[model samples]
Target: MTSPIQQPSRRAVLRMVAGAPLLLGASAALAVATSAPALAAQAGWRWCERCSGLWYSLNGTRGTCPAGNVFDGGHHSNGSGNYILKTVEDGGRGQGNWRWCGACQGLWYGGNPTLGYCPNRGATGHTPIGPYPTISSYYLIEDVGNRDSPGGQEQWRWCYKCAGMFFDGNTPGGSGRCPKDGYTHSVTGGSYVLRQVP
Candidate 1:
């Protein structure tokens, strides 16, 4: 992507194409009404919305660019499918790093903030948590036999020690224990605690 200064003036270029009013910060509809020359508005341009490094005038109602873009549409996002934007390429750090706002579903730049991605970016891991053989202190439920999702008839547990999953509550490949005999699962983060059933 081109840097802000290197970017061509939106108005100058637009005028050559269709003679749209160069609102000098004036929005096509709401472009700043400053009466500045179109070239000036395009020169010190700032983005209205944020994502994938795209920006538009703060004045206009939202709409897609001639180029196909998802956020360009008026519809806002929940930031479930967000990405990063930077003045620097290849995820590099610099004075301009953007964080996708899950609420606005837009990119916010100019803050030089810590780098982060939205949770919907698949940040969770699928690591095996526990195969606990004996009851756990944190959990307080009776153990029920393992259950499986539909379309199958099998369940597995993870051995916290061996760091492997085992079948039928076996301790094989695991060091974690199934709570004594009357425990239920109480999951936290990526781990589970066995709770005694009332």
Candidate 2:
């Protein structure tokens, strides 16, 4: 009998060739597994040497993606706290929470973590006090050409059914406000004059 290696049968060789895909696929998967972490480090995906999984950084400096936190439209307050802001949807899981209108990018990197207020991306200060004609608190904003530095203006409004106040840093004066348009409040009589945030 000829040696198996020296005289391999055509059928055996064909089987080996047919199995090549499985072997190659396994090798490719292994390569990806070994290389993924490096890519995460190089490609700017969120990484936590201390963290277990994917994360985020506004300026690629810091942000956390904890195991319990959800990704889409959520936030990594500081390099740890995860607050999935609900502005994009209806009242964040119905708990009634609002997010600051600042750039979320800076909010994590430049986060004070001390103050009750957190700044958005690249923001150096808190919301300024100014005047406007209407506000929505949603509903984003559009300055076109104003002067607080760049953007436009912001403010908070009273909501009835939600029975709370939602701050709108995007829109100033709303087309309509609560009590002025049939919304109820506990106002004996108080006027909220425009006050600058000093």
Candidate 3:
């Protein structure tokens, strides 16, 4: 005759029931992380102390700056902080159409039908750094208007005069120098935040 099957002990049943919630929670966390959009970030973008404009510093040649230079008339990065820029390919959580200008090495908006003003290009407009279709378009996250991102530096704005991104975080109510304008860069758009690359 076959023996009857034994039932699990009361203690064993209680242990599994207690651990069920923990296992489920872990699975939920993993799912959320995997479903999130991927963010690609590049460091070496920096603020220009002289012109107060944002520029890419990874290149060997420093592009022209609106503010004249002592040596080569290029962008002066003295005491400037290195910033990290993120590109979300899926159009996630930020403003798009931001592009790197090869002509001046400054970041400018590329969405306009007419190319915006470029100090280096002399009214021709800023040139995108890379070739067509392969050019990198960046997404800038606004740090203003109820979006408080404490991890990045705030008060960075788009210059209406130059159509280039510039820093307005100076003391005593002074905006950084503008290349297009003889004086400071005029802020008109959203306040953007850029994380300093440590």
Identify the leading candidate in terms of TM-score.
3
Model 3 per-residue lDDT tens digits across residues 63-166: 88888655778887889887866654434567778888877888987777756777778778888754333466777877655332346688889887778898
Strongest candidate by lDDT: 3
lDDT of 1 at 188: 20
Model 1 quality (TM-score): 0.17
Question: Model 3 reaches what TM-score against the true structure?
Answer: 0.73
lDDT of 3 at 76: 76
Model 2 spans > 4 angstroms off: 1-24, 36-38, 41-104, 107-198
Q: How close is candidate 2 to the true structure, as a TM-score?
A: 0.17
Error of 2 at 20 (Å): 16
The lDDT of each candidate is: 0.24, 0.25, 0.69
Stretches of model 1 off by over 4 angstroms after superposition: 1-10, 13-105, 108-113, 122-198
For candidate 1, write residues 1-198 as lDDT tens digits: 112223334444555545554434435434432222212211211222222112222223332211224544442222212211222321111222222232222232223232222212212211111122221111111123221111211232322222112123222422222121112222221222121111
lDDT of 2: 0.25
RMSD in Å for candidate 2, one decimal?
A: 23.5
TM-score of each model, paired residue for residue: 0.17, 0.17, 0.73
